[model samples]
Target: MRNLFFLCAFLLLAVACKSPEARRPVQRSSGSFIKESAERNKKLYKKEEAIINKIIAQNSDKDFESNPNGFWYFYNVKDTLSTVMPKYGDVVTFTYDVKNLEGTTIVSEKEIGLQQYQVDQSNQELISGIREGLKVMKEGETVTFLFPSYKAFGYYGIEEKLGANVPIQSTITLRSIESSEEN
Candidate 1:
């Protein structure tokens, strides 16, 4: 009887010690949502490209790069924001407000103050597109980049809350408020 009791206790303890990874719920719903979103985003992206191309062809003021993978446009500002580009390992801080093209607030840090993060560290610290976008900027420079869903969150929106058919295009306006001196 004592041996049986010990075996049960050992089994309980072993199970308790298992890492969270072992307990993670199977992400069937999220996986399916992502697959559907990717399909929808592809069609929307093509439409966006056509619209952008039409706009560019009609206007001479805007300069941009066009390609199937993604598009980037740069506008020269009258005031020089900053020249400091944070290096790969450096920590950078900034304040930002994200909105739709019509200026509907989707996210903002103005009420919350500045946000800080270390560049290039993946996973929880930063989104892949934000990481990629920051690498191209310098301190004090403000840039607005429109990212397709693949560059933003791929097929899965952050937290799987954003709908599959919801467009993936996001206009990210970034200001490099500060960077570590070592950067």
Candidate 2:
């Protein structure tokens, strides 16, 4: 009888006590964090713009055209007669070479073989620069895209595959793009 009385009292006490987490309301302010993050990203974007501008000015051979996404590009070679271009979901095959600000080669099509990508068609997503640039070119055109890390490969720098990091601008040439449907 005494043991039962103690057990009942313990259970009652436990039930009366509130959880610590429940008692304290969360203090984090989502809006403040978001505002701060946006400011930081804006600064990063500006730095990238500066780097891209410098590269464009230094290269005399390439006449760059800017895009809203903060990259600049120029056609090294383009088909004057072909009007057909790659569209979304179209499979595109081309050769490319990836290089960094210092003109160091990151990867070359010669090292790998003809690269194949479906236009905005893959769950395996290509970088923003490549996808957007492809949309602008005809099958026989070759475009050189100059963009910052954010457009190429942000913070996570293609460590093993392509070694890229922010503040580092890269230039990639879409040597030749042919739609799979054409073949």
Candidate 3:
């Protein structure tokens, strides 16, 4: 009986010593979904850009400048003298309004009254275009910006007035910039 037990243990150890095999996935991904999504985004961006460019071309009177961040702007009140633009932690007070490409007001300045934001420091609810636009502005300067859908609202738009993936024009007036360096 002891010999039989020894034999069974040896057989079990021998069977357990077999090298493990790597697991194979039941189904492999072809990466087509990712590629297709990327292609779709590229096309959407191009379409929006074309529409913005056409608007810019039609309004040649304004000296619209293209930002590398994928937007366009023309300063309604450019402060040539003041070299001070808001820096990190500086508090800036501004008022802004949004309109469609057709120049229909979607959000009035009165609707979004005096906005006080800390430059690059606050978790304030501002869009990407407005955030970037604020960094380029000096106190007492007003600029009109043309933002693509992604920069403005992207997939989620303003509740009822604005729809998803729609470009918009916003005019911002920088009232004051309280320097953080003072404190």
Best TM-score among the predictions, by candidate number: 3
Q: Give the TM-scores of the predictions, in the order they appear.
A: 0.54, 0.73, 0.86
Which of the two candidates, 1 or 3, achieves a greater lDDT against the reference? 3
Could you arrange the candidates by lDDT from highest to lowest?
3, 2, 1
Sort all candidates by TM-score, best to worst: 3, 2, 1
Off by over 4 Å in 3: 11-25
What is each predicted model's overall lDDT from 0 to 1? 0.56, 0.71, 0.95
lDDT of model 1 at residue 130? 60
- Model 1 residue 177 lDDT score: 41
TM-score between candidate 2 and the true structure: 0.73
- Summed over model 3, clashes come to 0
Clashing residue pairs in candidate 3, if any? none
Worst 10 residues of 3 by lDDT: 174-183
Total colliding residue pairs, candidate 1: 1
- Tens digits of per-residue lDDT, candidate 2, 1-183, equal 999999999999998895665555568665988899779878888887887787888897777899886678888776789777777667777666677767677777577566678777676556777777777777766677877777778767676866535543333344445556644
- List, residue by residue over 1-183, the lDDT tens digit for candidate 1: 999999999999999998776566665455878899778767887876665556557656766554344745454331365556667667777655444333455555565356676776534455455666666666665555555555565455545345332223333334444445665
Between prediction 2 and prediction 3, which has the larger TM-score? 3
Candidate 1: TM-score? 0.54
Residue 54, candidate 1: Cα error in Å is 4.9
Worst 10 residues of 1 by lDDT: 163-172
